[model samples]
Target: MSSTLQLVGMGVLAIIALWVLLQLVGIVFSIVSTIVSFLVSLLLLAIIAVLVYFAFTALT
Candidate 1:
C-alpha cells in the first residue's frame, strides 16, 4: 500500500512539473511575439515616414 502511494505521489509531482514547464514556454512565446509585433510596427511607421518625406520633397 505504501509503495502504491509513493507511485501516485510521483505521478502527481511529474504532472505538476510538466504544467509549470508548459506555463514557462507559453510566457516565452508571448514575449517573443510581442517583440516581433513591435518591430513590425516600427517598420511600418518608417515606411510611412519615407513616403511622406518623398511627397513633401516632390511638392517643394
Candidate 2:
C-alpha cells in the first residue's frame, strides 16, 4: 500500500514539473517575440524617416 502511494506521489510530482517547464518556455517565447517585433518596428520607422528626408530634399 505504501509503495502504491509513493508511485502516485511521484507521478503527480512529475506532472507538476512538466507543467512548470512548459510555462517557462511559453514565457520565454513571448519575450523573444516581443523583442523581435519591436526591432522590426524600429527598422520600418527608420526607413520611413529616411524616405521622407530624401523626398523633402528633392523638393527643395
* Best candidate, TM-score: 1
lDDT of 1 by residue, 22-57 (tens): 999999999999999999999999999999999999
Each model's RMSD to truth, in Å?
1.2, 1.3
lDDT of 2 by residue, 1-60 (tens): 999999999999999999999999999999999999999999999999999999999999
State the local distance difference test value for candidate 1.
1.00
Total backbone collisions, model 2: 0
CA lDDT of 2 in candidate 1? 100
lDDT scores of the candidates, listed in order: 1.00, 1.00
On a 0 to 1 TM-score scale, where does candidate 2 land against the true structure?
0.83
Poorest lDDT segment (10 consecutive residues) of candidate 2? 1-10
